[model samples]
Target chain A: MIGLRALATGDALPQVKPEVMRMYNMRFCPFAQRTRMVLLYKEIPHEVVNVNLRRKPKWLFERNPFGLVPVLEYNNEIVYESSICDDYLDELYVERPLYPKDPHRKAHCRVVMAKYDKMVPSFYKLIKPDENLRLQAKETISEEMKSLEIELGDGAFFGGPQPNMIDFHVYPWFERLTALKSIVEFDILQENNLHRLQLWQKRIEKLTCVKETMQPKEWHLEFFIGLANKNPQYDIGLPQSKV
Target chain B: MIGLRALATGDALPQVKPEVMRMYNMRFCPFAQRTRMVLLYKEIPHEVVNVNLRRKPKWLFERNPFGLVPVLEYNNEIVYESSICDDYLDELYVERPLYPKDPHRKAHCRVVMAKYDKMVPSFYKLIKPDENLRLQAKETISEEMKSLEIELGDGAFFGGPQPNMIDFHVYPWFERLTALKSIVEFDILQENNLHRLQLWQKRIEKLTCVKETMQPKEWHLEFFIGLANKNPQYDIGLPQSKV
Candidate 1:
C-alpha cells in the first residue's frame, strides 16, 4: 500500500532507485505538466508515456477508468489527478518540499491555483478577434495579473524568492498571457505591470528541470485551437485544466 | 499545529465540539453539495447555511477570497475550495474515513472526482439549447454517464455499498441528471437501464442527515436555470420560464 503524501507543482522529485514508477500524460496538457513538473523537480526517474488525448491510447483508458492525463503509476499503484500526483510526489520523496508548511499560505496558494485552473484559461479559449471580446480578454487578463501581482507583491515569486508549489502550478497558465497577447492583441502581459511575475517567469524558465519537461510551443497552440473548435475529449484548458 | 492526516469523505471529521463546524453551501453547486453530503454521512453536527446563489451572503466573500460559497470555518481556520474543504474535513476528523485506506483506490477516487469536476461541469456549461449544442450535449452527456456507470457497475455507489469519498465527489453532478430529465430530457437517468444510479440516488437521499441539509427546491430550480442563462454562477435547476 502506497502511503499518503503531499507535494506541490514544480519541485524536482528525486528519482527513486528504479522501481516501475511511470507517469501517463501528454506533453501539451497543463495538468500533465503539473505532475511532470514535480517529477523533474524531484528528479524522480520514471517512464513517461505520452497519450494521444484525442485518440486516447488504449492502455491509458485501461489504466485510468476516468481517461484523463497525468496518471502516475508507481509500482503496482496508480495515482491520478495532477494535485494528487503532486501529493504522491511529496510522500514518495521528502527531501525537497514544494508545498508550504504554513496552512494559510498553503490554502491561499491552492486557491490561486484553482482560480487559474478554473477561470483564467477561459480568457485564452473564449477570446476572439471580435472587437469587444478582444478588449474583454485583455481587461480580464490584466485584472487577473494585477490581482496575482498584489498577492505576489513584494515577493520575487509566489512563495518569496523561490517558486513554490503554487508558482509551479500557475506559471504555465500565466505563460498563456503571452499567447493571449499575441493572438488577441491584448497587451495584458505589459499592461499589468507584473514586474515580479515577469522576473519569476524568466527564473522558472531557466530551471533545467522545468525546461526538460516543458511542452513544445506549437503543440499547445494546436491543442488550444482544437479545444476552441468544439472538439470533444480534446479539452486542454477548459476550466479543469489543472488538478 | 494541525498534524498531517487523511480520512475518507463520508467519515466523521475531527470535532472541536457540537455545532461549532458550520458549512455554508447548497445542494445544487456540485462543489458545495459534495461536502454537504460528506458531512451528513459522517454524522458530524454542522449548521448548514443555505446561501441564495443569486444573492450570496456578504460573509461568504469574507470567508472566501473568490466569494464562492462552500467555505468551512472551524476553530478559527478557514479552508476554501470544495474538494479541499472536504479533504480538510477528512483530515481533521478521521473517525469515519472518506479517503480510501489504499493509496491506489484513493487515487482512482481523485481522478473520478476530477473528471466530474472538470470534464462533466465544463461540458455542461458550454452546452446551450441550440439544436447543434443540444444534440452535442445529448451525445456528451451520454458518453459521460455511460463512462460513469461503468465505473459504478455492480457497486452500491461509487466506492461500494456504502457511499465513499468518490461518490460524494461525483454524485452531485450526475444528480443533475434528475433535474436534467425534467428540463432538457436526457436519457441517462431515464433510460440507459441505469437501475443502479437511480437506486443510488434514493439511498443517498434517504440519509436522514443528508436530506436535512439540502436547499429549497425552488431555489435549486432557479439556480439551474440561472446557470443555463449564465446570469448566476451555477444553474439553479428551476424551470426555464423562471430564467
Candidate 2:
C-alpha cells in the first residue's frame, strides 16, 4: 500500500535521479492515481514522491505553478495535469499506444473521457453523509453508468478488444465504488441493468497493474468518511488514533 | 460574410456532398467559431450547416447526442466538441499541422489552452450588466491576461514563429474582447502592462482566416449586450426588433 508523507516549508526537495521519471502524488487522490496507473501499465522506470497535499512543498509549486499533482518530471522538464501527463507518457513511450491510430476513433475516445470527467463532482457528492445529496449523487451516477453501458456497446472495453485511454481515464472513479457503496449503500452496478459495467469492473481488477496500484476499500472508506466528518487528520494517511 | 441561417424542425438536412466536409455551427457561438477558424486556416473544402440552438433540429441531435456545434460530418460519420473536431481536422489534413511535432511541446500547447479555457466564465461575467460582477470578472480577466503575457514569452504565437492549436483554441474568447470593451469599457490589453498580449492580438487579426471569419465589433456588441439584457430573441440569430 502507498503511504503519504508531509513536506514542511524547508523540507529537502526529492532528488531527480538521472534517467528516472518522478511522479509527485497523493495516495488517495484519484487524479494522481490516474497518472500512476498509466505509468504502472507502461512499466515505466520511475520513482514516486508522495506529498501530503495539505502541506505542499515549495518545490512542488515550482515544478507545477498550480502546485497540483501528479506532476511528471522527466528529461529536466516537469508536466502536471493527469490527462496531459498521460498524453505525454503515451506519446513518449509507445509500447502499448493508449490512443487509437484512427483519427476519428481517437477523437471519440477523448469525447467519451470528457463525458465521464463531468461526473467527478457528482461522485464527490456521494461521499457526503447527507442522505438527500447521497440520493441525488446516486441518481447522477446511475445515469452516467447507463451512458457508459451504451458507450461500451458490444466491446469488451471502450476502445474495443482492448482497454485504451478511455478505460484508463475512467477506472480510478470506479476503483472507489466500494468506498462509496459502504457509505451510500446503493448498488450502482446492478447485474440486471449494468451487467456490462459489472463485468468490466471485474476485468479491470484482474489486470496486475490495477491490482497492484489500487488501495484497499477499507483505506478509502476510512479516509473519505473521516473527510466527510471534518476530521483534520484524515489526510495523515492513518487512523485517527494513530495520528 | 458567412450568413446565419437557423435550421429548425422540418428543415432539410444539409446534403452530405460526396467528398466534402460539413460543419454544423451557429454564426455567433465562440465554440463553433473555433472550428470555423481551423477549417478556414486549412482551407479545407467543407459545408456549414447552422443549427438553431433554441429549437434544435432532430437531425442535429441524431448526429450529435448533445445537439451541440460545431459537429464535423465526414465519411458518413459525425464528431462534436470544438477541441476534438479541431484535433480530427489537424490529424486528417496535415498540410498545416495545428499541433506541435515534439511530444513535450504538444503537451505544453494543450496545457496553455486548458488554462485559457477556464477564463471563459469570467469573460461572461464581464458581459453581465451588473457592475459588481463586471468588476469581479475584470479582475479575473486581468490576472489571466497577465499570465498570458508571461506565457507568450517572446513568441509571436503560443507556438513559436506561427499560430498553432493553442493560439486557435484561445482566440475565440479574445475575438469578443472588442465587444466586451464597447460594453464594459475595460481595457484588458493595455499598451504598457499587456503589450505582448496586445501585439499577439494584432498578429492574430492579420491572419487571413481570422480576418475572413470574425464578425465586426458592432455585431458582437449588439448580440452579447442583448443577451445580457435577457432579450428573448437572442437565439433567433436576428436582432431583437426583427423577432
Candidate 3:
C-alpha cells in the first residue's frame, strides 16, 4: 500500500470512494508511521495517499491546514495530528483496543506518551551540525535510555506483555534511532546500560504491525542524509530508472 | 479554595488524605487553569497545593518529573500535563461528560485543541524583546483569531450550545489575552474582525467554572509583567502584611 510515490505541488487529488477511510501521509515520516502502525495493528481498511512535504499539493492543505501528514479522512470529515489520529482509530475500532481500559492506567499511557514527545527532540539533536551539540544530544539520549530501561523493568513492552498505544507512539522514534546512529556514529543503546530498553526494542521489531508499516533503515538514512544536506528527497524510494 | 499562597523550596508537602485527589498548581499558570476549570465544572472533590514555579519545591519534581504545574495525584498515582489530567478526570467522573459521545465529533474537538495548542505560542511571542517579532506575532495571533472565529461560526461554544473539554482546553489562553494586550499595548480582539470569537470569549467568561478558577485580570497583568521583567511573582496576590 505504501509503494505509491508522493504527490507534489499541482498534482491532482487522488479519488477515494465514499465511506473508505483515507490517510494523507508522508511515507518516511516517523509521526505518520505512528498512525500507520495503528492502522495495520487494527487491520482497519484504509487508503494511503502520500504527499510531498516540500512541494505539498494544494489539496493536502485543504485536508490539514498544518499540511502535516497522518491526517485521517473518513465520512468526509478529517482528523489531523498523529496521536489524535491513532486515538480516533482506537476509539472507532474497538476490536483490538490499543489503550488501557482503566482510566488511571490510560492516563499513565498518556503521561508516557508526553514524556516520549519531550525526548524526541534529543534524537533529532543528534543530527545537528555542531559537534558539541551532537555530543550533548548523545549524552542526553543515553540518559533517556537509562531512564526508559528502568521504566521497562520486567515488562516485554510498555504495555507489559504486548505493545499498546504508548508502544506505537514511541516505537517510530526508536526505529529512526538506528538511522540517527548511522549519521552520528554513536550506538546509544549499546553504549548505555539500557538492557531492558534494548530488549524491548528487539521485541517491538518482531511485531507484524511494525514489520508491515516500517521503512528500511537505509531508506531512513537516505532521507535523513538528504534532509541534513538541505535538499530533502520527499520521494526517495520510488523507482526512477525509466526516467 | 485558591487563596493559599504558593510553597517554595524547602516547604513541606501538604498532607493529602487517602483516596483524595490533589492538584499541584501555580496560581497564574494558564495551563493549570484548564485542569482547575474542569475540576470545578465537574464538582470533583480535590485539594489544591500551589507551588512557586521559580523556586519550586523538591517534592514538586517528585510529583511531576517536568516540574510543571497541573499535576494530579490520586490514589498515590500521579498524572501530569494539563490536558491529560483533565482527560483523566473526565474519564473517571463521567457524570457531566466533557467530550462528545460520537467518535468523529470527539476527534474534531481534539483537532481544534491541537490548533489551539499551536496558536498559544504566538500569544507568548507578544511579550518578546524584539519589536518586529512582537508585531509579527500580533499579526499571526490576529490571523489565528480570524480562523478560530470561522470555526466557531454560529455556535455558542466549540462544543455547540454548552461548553465541553475543547472549551476548557482553550479558554485559559483566551482569559489571558487581555493581560497580553495590556503588555503589548495592542487590543487584538478590538483590532481584528473576530466577532464570533469575541462573543465566544464573553460567553466563556460568564461560566461558573470560569468565575471560580480564574484570577482577576489585574493579577494576570502583574504576573505577566513580572515574567517579562525576568522576576516572576509566583505568589502575587498573597498578603504580605504579616511578614
Cα-based lDDT at residue B177, candidate 2: 86
Off by over 4 Å in 2: A1-10, A129-132, A232-243, B1-3, B9-12, B17-19, B232-243
Looking at model 1, residue A49 earns an lDDT score of 57
The true-versus-predicted C-alpha distance at residue B55 of model 2, in Å, is 2.8
Each candidate's number of clashing pairs is 35, 0, 0
TM-scores, chain A, per candidate: 0.78, 0.90, 0.94
Docking class of 2: medium
Top of the candidates by TM-score? 3
Model 2, span B1-243: residue lDDT tens: 222466777877766774678898887889988899999999998887777776788999888777788988888767788888998999888898998788878887877777678788998888666899988988888888888889889999987798888788888888898666766776888733898888899999999989877887777877776576665232433565533
Pairwise DockQ winner, candidates 1 and 3: 3
Candidate 2, A137-185: lDDT as tens digits: 8888888889899998888887688778888898988889866676676
For model 3 the local lDDT of residue B87 reads 92
Task: Report lDDT (CA) for all predictions.
Answer: 0.65, 0.80, 0.85
Q: Using DockQ as the measure, what is the rank order of every candidate, best first?
A: 3, 2, 1
Model 1 has a DockQ score of 0.25
All models, RMSD in angstroms: 10.3, 3.2, 1.9
Compare candidates 2 and 3 on lDDT and give the better one: 3
